[model samples]
Target: MPRNQWKPFQSITVQWISLLLVCLVALPVANASEPKATDIVVRAKSKDAKFIGSSMGGAMVRIRDAESGEILAEGLTEGSTGNTDLIMQQPHRRHQSIAEGAAAFRTSLMLSEPVFVTVEVLAPYIKKQARVAAQTQVWLVPGKHLDGEGLVVEIPGLVVDVLSPQTHRYTQMADAPFPIRANVVMMCGCPISEGGLWDGSQMEVAALVKKDGRDFATIPLALEDVNTFGGELQPDGPGLYQLLVYAYDPRTGNTGVDQVSFIVR
Candidate 1:
């Protein structure tokens, strides 16, 4: 072949080699950007108690992208509240697995890179008035497994439900003393009782009364049974009476309230 013909062939050969090199160099980078399945476990824990689980109607969990507001995973925790001794009685040490058999919401996220995510939990799903929401933010690294105790969000506050002097009740003034009753429990649905794990005796339960929107009186409730508190309200004169019943634990600073209104004829 002539030298000019040979030059054209050389240029074509070099172009082909350049293209091949570019593809080879880009392969690893493209693979690195591919999404990875990352496992995560999330648990909703009642403050000073155990996990919020099936007995309490489980807890709803939502994992979302912190910046984008996109939801990554959504579900409810399943299983038990956890072992009473392990979660409450035993003293926790560093790296202790308190959630070995506890309830959890487990899911895998497809992540190409690290993500800042927000984990939100709404607990005791069945109890609308007593339900509480808690959330936390964390950076999730691709391929990292958040197992073991995983991400635990503590939920504080008690669950208070007014059981007597029901909402919109019409009472006769002849029934001078109106009976008041309430049920109080931990956020995990743990029973509160005198001399029990969660002692009702240590908590103060009361009913704050208001007549026609005016401050009436405060009546202290005594523990009547497990998780139950009862008292009587002696109305001075019958009108529209509102009752706000509350339970407070001085030691743990856990408190909850429930209210009801009734008309006396």
Candidate 2:
């Protein structure tokens, strides 16, 4: 994740408290070289939102008019020194400006030989979720048509350690009239090695519910005795139900939630 575009998720409750959500941030970055004279550089390293560093190795930075797509500001490095930095004349005011400059730079490549320029975007926050599924196999009737016994839910955009095994398996007892069992598997991007570092120690699941294309409910769920982050719903006897999984990041107090649907007989 680009530094500027990266952010921890935080939860918020609406006035109705029907659905839960988190903030989303977007950031954008670069390409390679051509004529030293026409080339521009957008720095990737920084502490603040704006690009506030000196340019090195004859590199230059340019800020263009957002609407007209005209060059409004420019900064160029003085020599071949690799460590040198070139600060932009005017700091980028918003994400749109960076996007505009990126577009202009890309356009330049088609007209003339490609001049490699790097562009980056900074935003507020991003959201991510953990994956969920039945840990064990539940009994399914042959052709008698009983409700499906297994449930699987996946969360997208999650970061995992990637070095160790990334599979999780567990089982949950079905509640009430359903009278069966559920197995869940959580596949996280973070590998097993990284799992111990997490505050939750284990990833849990939750549902992001919607109805008729509008937000409706967010339910925390769990398996067996473990509070995986969701609750079981009583079946209406038949039809489809949306199931989701969520991961809580204790470090940033952020939560990621995603969903799928299931049918009950």
Candidate 3:
């Protein structure tokens, strides 16, 4: 073959080699931008107390993409409520983890770049009336783990359950001054007692009564036993009576309520 002919073929071959090298160099960069799995942890905690755990029915957790409003993960938190002394009594330092082995909802998201997410939690899941919802937003980075006491959503409220003067009860006016009883506890199901932790003596509990849909008496209930508050409700005449029982902690601004109805003959 002629030398000039060989020169042209060599130039064409060099151009193809250059293009191949460019593609090889760009491959890693493209791969780096692809989606990756990111780990996230979320927990629901009672205000001024422990985590919301299995005992009270673990909290429901939902993770959504902030920008798109797409759900990323949905599940319930599982495990214990955590150590009482560590979560409630001890002072916490920066970066201290109180959620070790505590209840949490864990999930992974596929993300290529940093993404903003909204985490919503409904705690004390079994108690519909006492359930509290909380939420928070965070930026998730690919490959980053939002673990170790992860994102804590604090729920503020008490669990109020009316115990006496049962719902839909029928009674005579003579029974008007009947006992009103209720059981109150922290949102985490922590017991409330007169002189113990989560003291009921420090809270205000009462029954707001209504007769035949009209304004009636407001009876203040006194702490009678562990998590129990009692009082008396007296109806003036024969009518439908409704009792709305409530508990409030003035110090923490936490409140909860439950209601019942009865008919007087």
Candidate 4:
């Protein structure tokens, strides 16, 4: 074959391949990436459980595949780093520009289809490595970002010291619900009424009951005052109980966890 005759054929083949590549790149995440799914995002918010306030930072979040237990993504909710999550940035540019979750966390992951996802959050309330923690499972749809249910964690640097009944190894009436009280401020530095990014009223407070150093149950405590909450432990029978008072500000993703020990006799 003459050189000129072969040139046209070669040019056509190259052009066809270039178009094919562009098409592939333009395809949705599912068809473009392996497993044939879309990219999704997970977000977090912190609220004060003790003072009904909010914290500015100090939260560690983890997203995992419920079935495989694979860690999909993880990050801190410290407001220092702007939330770079595609979900938070998506649907519009203004939303990303003015988004106010300084203590919030956002993580992106890819999936092929709809599946269950588990989100684990740890918020250090007292800087003692003890954290206000919460876990929830959410159904994530392909190509969609899912906002996890709010997780209540302890506010860093805040402690809800149990006041009513001194925490001790002594036993209480097993059949009776023991009274509980604590003094706490959920805000990171200032009071909730300061009227700034760190507010307390937006936080949710929940109580956790653990058995032998393991979580056994949760009781949501009611705020009595600015920084006080009242709740009770009604043990079924005589046993050791570890009660953790927790605060989480979903707005900033800050958390606080406090605990006292008691015995049921």
Candidate 5:
């Protein structure tokens, strides 16, 4: 192993190693510039699953750095029509309900590097306190897409259990007792009553029965328990009846409205 003999072999090996290193580093940079985007679809609804839609009609989605809390990308989950930011933009109309607006929110986000981040959903414009803020952690890979779990924000609103009618389309006889079972909660999913965070004195639940596009009768609901409320509806006559149940927490001025269309024999 003479020093002169080693020099020639070492030079060739050094050149081979440098070429290998260059290829490895250049590969990632070339792929990075092409820019792969991740499509994040957000869906919002009430915690009970009885209803699907935000009172605000749409929600805001923000992608933030999980560690630093810095927002990276932002977009909206609006009505069937795109860019429906606020509920007011597309007011409620016949056949077009609030649920139509809060159906799905879609956005594509692109990042230079893959990192751990948080997806934050906010429905602040919801006046009825029908929804709460939602956040979830997800791994954002630069070249792939990620789906999120269903984000539920309970509105301090009313949910009625139609025990008698079985189906929203089913008809109840005028003589049969249409017993109503309902649950009342705060926007944050806290049960409310006379002495809770939302004063029971100001809380009330009522069903507005509409016939022929006019107000027919208003049946008051009695609170059976903290979160349980019920009422019996004896329709004056048999026909097509529209029922609108309203739950209100006067303390915070949060209200929720639920509707049902049923036939009365």
Candidate 6:
């Protein structure tokens, strides 16, 4: 073949190869911008399930089955700030926000069998209500520990109202080894007996008991030794008992007492 005839054919073949190369390289870059449906990350045994962000602004998430696309669970990770960092106790699926309006989905797989959970975080346009802090001032009537099984008191709910502190009172009563009913009392901003020490000249602790809605007896206790606040109930009686505690500190005069009621079996 002549050299001029071969040159023209070679040029045409080279042009065709260059076009094919451009097609292969440009396809991947276009696919990179598309949103992904699945993101799998393997967690260690000790790590907790948490959102990968912090202070997410009203972010919401949902979990779904990968193969079936059935929704399983969901939660909101929006904090006061705009980052979605949260700790989930169980395993599930998660969808996160890529932009303010658009979203990108991600999946989390747990290696630990016990703590398997998936959570989806979403972003809502409107703001949500703020959570209230728990009120420590409202205390159980009888305090924390009890000698018998029936007498126990705890804060009632998850959210304690500050404006209405009285709503948080909760009591637990059950059959006990002994016939005693314990009660709780508190005095704030004033000297109260703690650490087993009380001033002999300062105060007097009093408990007035009533049975069947009738006044029974008033027992006065020396502030120096008034630690236990429970009393033995009559084994034969089936009525309810009421207990009221009053404090008299000479420096602060007489402070009022709180009334608590319990039943006897």
Highest TM-score, which number?
1
RMSD of each: 1.8, 29.7, 2.0, 11.5, 14.3, 19.9
Error of 4 at 141 (Å): 2.7
**lDDT scores in order:** 0.93, 0.29, 0.91, 0.58, 0.60, 0.34
Where model 5 places Cα greater than 4 Å from the true spot, the runs are 1-13, 25-35, 49-56, 80-102, 124-131, 147-265
Which candidate number has the best lDDT? 1
TM-score for each candidate, following the candidate numbering:
0.93, 0.28, 0.93, 0.39, 0.44, 0.26
Q: Which residue segments of model 3 deviate by more than 4 Å? A: 1-10
TM-score for candidate 1, please give it.
0.93
Per-candidate count of clashing residue pairs (backbone under 3 Å)? 0, 29, 0, 23, 7, 22
Clash pairs, candidate 1, are none
lDDT of 2: 0.29
lDDT per residue as tens, model 3, 217-249:
999999999999999987778989999999999
Q: Model 2 over residues 118-167: C-alpha lDDT tens digits?
A: 22221111212231111112222222221121111112223221110112
Tell me how far the alpha carbon of residue 115 in candidate 1 is from the true structure, in angstroms, after superposition: 1.7
Name the candidate, 1 or 4, with the larger TM-score value.
Answer: 1
Badly placed stretches (over 4 Å) of model 1 are 1-13
Better of 2 and 5 by lDDT: 5
For model 1, how does the per-residue alpha-carbon lDDT over 146-251 read when each residue is reduced to its tens digit? 9779999998999999999999999898997889999999999899988998988999999999999999999999999999999999998769999999999998
